[model samples]
Target: MTMTSAMPDGRAERASTKSFYLIAWRWHFYAGLYVAPFLLVLALTGLMMLWTSVLSGRDGEKYYTVTPAQTQVAVSAQADAALAAIPNGKVVQYIAPRTEEGAAIFRVNNGDASSMVAVDPYNGTVLGSWDRRNGLYDLANKIHGTLMIGDLGDRLIEVAAGFGIVLIVTGLYLWWPREGKGFGSVLVPQFAARGRQLWKSLHVTVGFYISLILMIFLVSGLSWAGIWGDKFTQAWSTFPAAKWDNVPLSDATHASMNHGGVKEVPWTLEQTSMPMSGSDAGKMGIAEGQPVNLDGIVAFARSIGFNNRFQLGFPADDSGVWTLSRDTMSNDSANPLSDRTVHIDQYTGKVLADVGFSDYGVPGKAMAVGIAFHEGDMGVWNIVLVTVFCLSIIFMSVSGMVMWWKRRPAGASRLMAPAVPGDMKLWKTGAIIMLAVSLLFPLTGAVLLTVIALDYLIVRRVKPLKRALS
Candidate 1:
């Protein structure tokens, strides 16, 4: 009698486990179907960006080779060379060469168009000039950010990233070792396995290995998304302008410092209001005889410890401050912890406000470090690790589709999604979990709810739709 009762209990437990597994598998399938393409694109573009940064540099071959001189020409002279390259051009920003051998990059505006002119610091010769946003690497970055479709594409990518979390979670649950399974089977792909089994092994193994990396990439990337990053997180993470004591705040925010809609300010100060120039409300940064120009600002920046690839933003108006910034966001500094931004009065050459990494709020600090790692700016190891992670993502995406294709019945026209388990208890629990996920990722949640409503209200009620989905 005891044995018989134990048998039924064991059966019941196994049945429950099987039901939960099936539900998780179904959701995984659904998520992969939609998210795989986006993941592949992101991985490819990300790989391109990584290599471009490593080889030609993010600004392209401009940073590659320049003969260093014992003494270099003045930054103002370099600016003149850059401006002379374009008719009626106004210099907006000057990016000091990362090294003595690197070319100085000047952002020039001519009417409605913007261009970046590279000049040799040694001779103030125009090395090259191109549209600021048209570089191959920049194109890759744009595709990675917005898919070249603006807001709608950004939203779609955001949703995909959010759902990618779901994929990782469900994938882990599905790949969890069953009783008696060995480490080799779980960790390594079995070459002996054929067809779907081979694909499944490869997929599960690679997915498990790269899960954490994928999560990090997803979260970091999402931090730049429109709704979640900009509206919510960025708003709270921004440095408070109240920190500037006795300085007159400008009507413009630090976002005005950005060039061609590209973020140039430190992540923490992007939303913070900039201090205006006009009042004698800052410490004198320039010498008595020096004028407030590119050369003076560069000298002031170096004196204030803004060294190694710091960017200088020329004053936009008479009241605007000359902005000097060094942050990992622009790859200006390798160390994210050393991020600093200073605004100098263009008229008085007085330092208006100076903010550093230590001054950032908790969220700001996290993003500062996170963005550095995300961009593989930590070191060569970071580049290698991220490159492997990107390749793995591509492999996993392709393998998943292969597995699905292999499993499909011959001549079947419908998607062979896993059947919904008959147990309402598990289904209800899943619904609750999904609800929580939706709340956390609003755009993802909206998409999930729409799919659920369609599945129940439309697909279930319509025979053709039901058949097609099943």
Candidate 2:
């Protein structure tokens, strides 16, 4: 009797395990089908932007590098030169040179278009000019973020990224060894296997190796998405405007300063209310009677620890404040910990609000660091590491498609998706998982539910549709 009981229990356990594997595989297959194309575009565009940034500097700013000189011209002179280059233009922001030999950059707005003017800091000579949004880096970034189609593209990318998280979870579950296979079989691709088996091995191993990094990429990338990141996560993670200490606020937020599709401010401050100028509510900043001009603001920026590379934003109007900022995402500094933004009263030159990395909330801090890593801004090592990781992503995507193709029967009219086990009885667990995913990622959860509903209500009842789907 004892021997018979043990035999039945072992068989039951094996059956349950197989059922779960089939469930995981089915979900993984569907998620991969939807996410692979998006992943390919994201990885390729990411690589293009990365190399462009590393080689030519952010937004092609390296095109204006200059030789160092003993004496330097005034900040006002540089702004004047930039404004002169673009007639009828107004200087919106000034970017200090990163190195002694680097040229200063000025953002000038003429009508609806924006231009970047590179100037020699030594003699205030106008080096050259380029459209801010027309550069290769900006163009690639446009596609990378929104696919260059605006809000609709943003929503699609957001959904893809949301589903990508699901893909990672299911892929990991599928990769977990259950056959008592040795570690080598899981980590190393089986060279002896041929055709579909070899491709499967490569896909599994590559997926396993890049899983962690891919997760980081997905979460960080999602934090920039429109619905989830901007509306949900970022809304709560941003630095509180209440911390500005009773300063009057403008209608605009710090994000308003981010012009021409370029991110000029740190993520944590993007949604925070911009403090209006002309108030006596700020602490003493520029010395009494100092002219609140470009030169004065630049000096004040240096006095408060902003050095080498930082942005000095002009007041938008009578109510706007001068913004001094530096962050890794903007290529202002390599250290995310050094991220800082200060708003100064335009008339009084008083510091209105000073926000640093330490002031950011938990989510804000994580995103700040995550974005630095995501953008490969830490150093040369970061760039190399990210490049390899991107290549791995591309390989995994291609390998997955190749495996699907090989597994597909010749002249098959159906998609050949993984079949769900008929004996599976894990609805309760699946429901809970879906609930958790819905709460965490609304867009992805909705897509999963829609697919489930369609499969049950339409595909299951229609013979042709069921055959095509399964």
lDDT of 2 by residue, 415-462 (tens): 998877755577557556745765587777777678779888998999
lDDT of 1 at 333: 73
Q: Per model, state how many residue pairs clash.
A: 0, 0
> Local error of candidate 1 at 382, Å?
1.3
In candidate 2 the C-alpha lDDT for residue 386 amounts to 93
Which regions of candidate 1 are displaced past 4 Å?
A: 1-7, 61-64, 287-289
Question: TM-score, each model?
Answer: 0.95, 0.96
* Candidate 1 pairs with clashing backbones: none
Give lDDT tens digits, candidate 1, residues 1-470: 43334567888677678778888888899999999999999999988888878777665534446898888899899999999999999999888888877888998999989888899989988988888767677888888989989999899999998899889888988999987797788799988999899999999899989998888888888888998888867987888888887799988998777664356677778788989998888876787679988888898788879876888888888788888888887878789988998888888888888889999999888888888888888888888888888999999999999988988999998999998776545777776765676558789988998999989889999998898888
**Model 1: lDDT of residue 330:** 80
